[model samples]
Target chain A: MTVSVPHSLDDAVRLLGEHPDAMLLAGGTDAMVEINDGHRRPNAMVIALNRVPDLRSWRHDPVSGTVTIGAGVTYTELMQEPLAELLPALAEASRTVGSPQIRNAGTLGGNLGTCSPAGDGLPVLSALDAEIRIVSSSGERTISVHDLMVGVKQTSLLPGELIAEIDLKVRAGWQGYAKVGVRNAMVIAVASACLAVDSEQRRVSIALGSVGPTVLRCADAEQQLSNAVDWTSGAVSPDAIREFGTLVSAASTPITDHRSTAEYRSHAVGVLGARLARRAFATSEGAAG
Target chain B: MSNQFFTLRVNGADHEIADSWLGESLLDVLRDRAGLMGSKGACTQGECGSCSVMVDDSLVCSCLVMAATAVDQEIVTIEGVAPIGAPSDVQQAFVDAGAVQCGFCTPGLIMAVHDLLDRTSEPTDTEIREELAGNVCRCTGYGRIIEAVQQVAVQRGGAK
Candidate 1:
């Protein structure tokens, strides 16, 4: 159980290229939990990413209208200023993750790495159409957030590839996240949804979580709501909003888990979707306005 | 296997930990090897803040941090919050407010309160509750804990 702490991205990827099977520890929120619970045993080298300076900073390119966040950036950092203002839904989701102790150590990359269906950050990334930059000693590549998540607790990442940064466009509209759990703070999502309204594109995107094997996008609901919105006035009728919720509920493929039932999850996601849509397009002065 | 040795700087003092497993958590190293028992381990998971500590400037669950990975970081535990045999202002407030019921979650709660006040001088009720949400106290029902924090805030020049 040798531990390697690399201070640079180059060295970290190089080590990873060498030991493709090495366990990558970022934030250690999930990995450490698995280790402590004896759910996972590692005989391979452990590569810790906390010291890599390149993976801890975020850059907002106003010209490009995009923000690239390093894989090592903690949730606490995401919920703060500058980034918070730019990525509102992500910030909201970050605030709901675990607790102050968990948020202080958890990272979006860790959330992506874990790739759980209930991951708080994934639904936001999905609705935002986030791009993931993957790197290795050999080279680098980019993939959409939707493509990166292959299944529950799985990713499409190759053996040596590590998530370098998350790219999110700064859209000109209202974007928010909401989740339903037994309690407010420190509870995993029984059901969650993210709504991002792209005024420029005249599109509304919706994504659901904890209801399927992966974070799912409700294309039908999104298209329906987008079409219903009065682009000039930014007004969405109540009937449209109701139908949108029904579409979202139809899109969900939830199963009965210990935390919640399938019927409740399906119902909860619809409510969350309608509530977020109503908030986004609340009045004549809607998200576009 | 040969012993894996590393040095951790805790509370302005450096302790050398030998024969440590790479899989051991910072909580394990602190309590078992460094002999610093102030940071208690309850859940051994991040859900419970019993093992909370400051790694660098951030307050984190020590159980979630790999011990070896914290080699170059500054670790501050409950013992380091004040001089031995003396209570810090926060600790004294906890006693005064009757925040201590069983005293098991006191250290972590104290660390959390210190972290919160250090960041926000006079935190609002919402801010205080949100900041200390991680440290769950089965006893006291959190009313006294909030009182202790509010008392410390006013005493520490954090005007309401």
Candidate 2:
């Protein structure tokens, strides 16, 4: 019945080492609901890490072509000026999050902690080839977003390890996020896609969410389109966009769930992929991102 | 387990409540402990904005917030925004536009509109709808509620 608040990363790691079974509470947007519904319980202890200073900030290294977002950076914070400019697709996805209230409290780390396939930020992370930064009293480790999400609401996070931040490259390209949902707001994505067209590398990356067990990367699509599109000129033909869409849709291994059907999810993601690709082709601002 | 004495500052006033569960929601603490009942407890989850409040200038559903987490944070409930006998322009606008029916969702809506107006002086219809998407009303069909927002905007001379 103890709720432990740690103020520093060392203190947090120490708390985790001491109480390996304790539940880590960042924003508690999803954790609290599970506790209230009697679906889950924090055994013996709850480590409240929201107050930890080191986990509450972010930094961008222009020379390294990467941005490291603190685990505590909420959706509300992500949608603001500087961070939004650096990661516009993530910012765009953040806007579609539950509500202002939810955005205010929900954190990027919390979304990773939950590891839900429907999580808005996951596809963006996948598209960007993001890496999750994990820490413990023992040491620190980094894993790709592709490997981090093992399954639905699951991860490979070991005992006593806490996610510290998300690290991703700042691609010199066009980036956009689009989702199909039941409503204009506050609805879980039936299907969502994040498209990042890297002009400098002459490549395209597409990630789809809620259509499979995990946030899925369209390797076939990215591979095929990298050859088809003229990435140097930042131009993509409509035919290329359609071909990319078809490949992304084929990548999804969806199931019929309460939110949507497998066929519809497939179709919706294809459409979103095509639309975002076309949008990225026309936009000039994402090269600096 | 030890119970800590939690002190919360709400609407320019401080209140102390002892021996409360750490997992108790901020919505419950405001209504049950501090006796500020303006934010209703309709949905204990994050979906319904009936328990909306401002915590450190950020809008969040109090139901989703832990009371232990909200300590020392500045909180403004609907009661604080418009005290018992006195109503803010947003509150009066709801009355003027007949936005209240069952009246349970009004306080939260008022708080939401209040928060929105604070940020954007003259928000468009689409903007209003998008911002208040979290606050759901079963009555009034939302037509008058939208009207009420416009009423407040007009009454304020397109300024906050």
Output the number of the TM-score-best candidate. Answer: 1
Best by lDDT: 1
Pairs with steric clashes in candidate 2: none
Model 1 C-alpha lDDT per residue in residues A1-289, reported as the tens digit of each score = 7889999999999999999999999999999989999999778889999889999999999999999999999999999998999999999999999999999999999999999999999999999999999999899999999999999999999999999999999999999999999998899999999999999999999999999999999999999999999988888888889899999999999999899999999999999999999889864433331
Going through the candidates in order, what is chain B's TM-score?
A: 0.95, 0.94
TM per prediction: 0.97, 0.93
Off by over 4 Å in 2: A282-289, B157-160
Query: After superposing candidate 1, which stretches have Cα over 4 Å from the reference?
Result: A283-289, B1-3, B158-160
Tens-place lDDT per residue, model 2, A7-65, is 89999899899888888998889987886676876557788877888888999999997
Give residue A129's error in model 1 in angstroms: 0.7
